[model samples]
Target chain A: MTGDTHYDLEILAELAEGLLDDATARRVREHLAVCDPCGESLADLAAVREMLAAVPVPAMPLGVAMRIDRALADEPNPFASVPVGANGLSKLSLVPALDASAEVDSEELATVTPIRRGRRVWVATLGMAAAAAGVFGASVLASSLMSAPGGTLAEPPATSVSTPERSPQRTLAYTVRASGHNYTSRELSGPLVGYFGPEPGTGSNNDEQLDACVQDKANELDRPPIAVDRAQYNGSEATVMAFWEDQSLDKVRVVVVDDNCRELRQDGLATWN
Target chain B: MTPPPEQPATPEHSAVAGARASVTDADLLARHIGGDPQAFSEIVKRHRDRMWAVALRTLGDPDEAADAVQDAFMSAYRKADSFRGDAAVTTWLHRIVVNACLDRMRRKSVRPVADDELIEAAERDTQLPDQTAEREVSMEVTAALKLLPSDQRAALVLVDMMGYSVEDAASVLGVPAGTVKSRCARGRAKLAPILSHLRNRTDLTRVSSAKGAELRDG
Candidate 1:
């Protein structure tokens, strides 16, 4: 067997798929006639392709069609609706519907409100402390701001709080906790509460008001969040909520704040931790 | 604007006639753009099944696939004016759906759930009793496909399963033809071992032994 002249797998795969040019295919065919191993390999690849092609095409689900109809009905001419500025560029405000499409239901949003209100207070307090502490506090404040909504926070929230737990040298003065796990930081409180229900210490009246607001917002939007939880972002903790449709996690919303509840950052569709 | 009042023919008859007519997809798109609302609906009715199939195989999660298809069609509706007419409407739609699936896959990778959860979800979707064996094999293939990198899996799905030509698959993938070819080859090479058990040919042992020897030598 002329095993010395074995073609690359890519070439053989292309030959099997009839993707190669005529000359190259002819050459591969000639080689395959003498090369038993190569021939078998080609046959195996061909079988794999056959099996893949045979994978059944499922019928379109009824829900998808209905959703599409509803969406189209709501926006008959999406292109025409795009507002144009003086420069002729489209001035598209962030559509709430687009955001709603990512979430599960109104209950998640309801859970997120109290947590957000609490975080805002803490962030405001932290912002003042950071301001008084000068550059170091400024850096923390900047990080805090970045973690807020509409701020350009790309990295996961876990990075800020997770490091102290993983690395011994970076001991934090304050305690940082999430999903029941605790880590200590010397600079601030370790407890980062991402509450789904009423905020602790808040009265039932306040809870009722928050729930009303959530319901109103939900009524306005077609889609709402599936679940909401508290998560720590950067050094600040926020109410982290997720919108899931069907079984997939569609979007995450983070309401980040500093320890003083002064520095507020609210973001929708943030990456899930 | 409303469509003109129809004659006393049945709806099914009209739909069948519509299907038989030589109205191109582009024609339907143009009609929709020109305010014929039913044109886009017709397009959706014709292609929704195939689009679902592509999304399902690519995503391996029925719920996610449905969401992806919804997103794709909505995007298509909104961006219909952006259609350049260089490719068939089906190809353009497939590209959008594939992209949506990839985006979901990327997000899922960033925050992966448990394997048990995934298997359970797949089982819930394929709960029919008559096709249990077929469903099992499909699930196995899907699980194996998930093990491959996203790009390789996309390439394999487009070319191998969906039967797109190499050039067309490359176009949809926005990669060079050579890259698509390599991705397919590498993807198949990985899948061969995983799927070998499904092959019942008499020459299986011989082929595997030859593959082993080749691996040892090379």
Candidate 2:
């Protein structure tokens, strides 16, 4: 027999195990019908396979199955949690149910709620610190004014104006509301409006490309998001709103900017629930 | 409250169909994405046994096997969305189980037994109950399997015995389907001669039993 006929044994093996695709299996079956040697080999493989099946599965030790069930129980849903890489991510193999769906129940949601609340608490705490510093400086201005001989303390200029009410690093609850239009639209909440701050770039801010990333973080954190109304922002700029669970007045910041990086309008509301 | 009686997994009243009815892997996954935690249970029930078997064979220790199976399933759950559904569900599960088993093996400090030693050990371990009716058959199969390489043994076990398709077996072994076929072929060739001898012994047993019965009657 030619070497090729001998090599066909591999295909026959797969065929014996029911692994061959229909086309491949058909070809192998045709060959087996005519080739007595291959047929006998196939028959032997089949018999051994049957015998192996007849041998009973070894009994698993006690509590082993229950322990497996428990491990499976603890496995978190990948969709609800984080995406692990293919190389060594333990999450990928264990939690099949978690991957299929995204609908979280209220109690399951409770586990995540603290994380959300913690984020809000941290953000609000930073905002409060900023406000407290402002208040202390304002008090000093009042003392200086009372000491003036003309008895006129110029109204302490509101520091809230012109100064963007956002710190550079305060983690904002940034959400992107995008729709297909002539111009891409985006919404900003928390601290950013005019630009995402200079990262040594020469040109204008590219919020259009950045919207996808912002939305990704939103999905990762499982924060409740307001619908990005597609109908309202057909073209031009889309209004961005960041929701802070802490009802601090200076918490929300909205920046409407044009394509050329000019700020069209900026509004910062520190209190948002 | 009285605990539920320990019933066989496949019960007459609560059939595999009913047990399967609550959720399937795909359904649980879909529900899990929507955030239902209970859906995870279905995935566990569906794959735990097969996962355990793969781990037990690959790792060879009960504790390690249990850990590997758990880790494999948990890892699969964590990456459920990444599963593109290109492979069959079984293949995907096997891939996870095999990876976990291999990982467990790698983490161990001790070296695995050499093939000759393993064969000897296995033969010694499976020593037949001398008087049992099934002894001869068990002895022959065990002896034959002991001679095959561990990889070939696993291939035969999964493909020939357990009835996984070649594609599924290959996916489990992380090898080519062609390799699986070759292994299966070699495995059978190695087993055939041994089985022929076993058949001869069986015939001898039948004849001897017949003679002894006649003597007793006479």
Candidate 1 lDDT over B1-218, as tens digits, reads: 11113211111222232453577779978877776655676677667756776787788777678778878988998788888888878778888999999999988784454678667756544322245556566666777787789899999888777677788888788889888988998888778767766555322333433443343233
Model 1, runs deviating above 4 Å: A1-39, A79-273, B1-22, B110-132, B201-218
Q: Candidate 1 lDDT, tens digit per residue, A1-273?
A: 266767755566666545678877677777777787686666566556656665544444333444454445445555443444576323212111222222223342223222232113222222212222222112322233224332344232232332233232332221111221011121012122222211111111223332333333333332333233233333234333333222233234433333233324433333331
Candidates' lDDT values, in order?
A: 0.51, 0.45
* Native-to-model Cα distance after best TM-score fit, residue A22 in candidate 2, in Å: 20
Superposed Cα deviation of residue A64, candidate 1 (Å): 2.2
Interface RMSD (one decimal) of model 1: 13.7
- Which predicted model would earn the best DockQ? 1
Summed over model 1, clashes come to: 34
Q: Each prediction's DockQ? A: 0.14, 0.10
Superposed Cα deviation of residue B25, candidate 2 (Å):
1.8
C-alpha TM-score for every candidate: 0.49, 0.41
TM-score of chain B of each: 0.77, 0.62
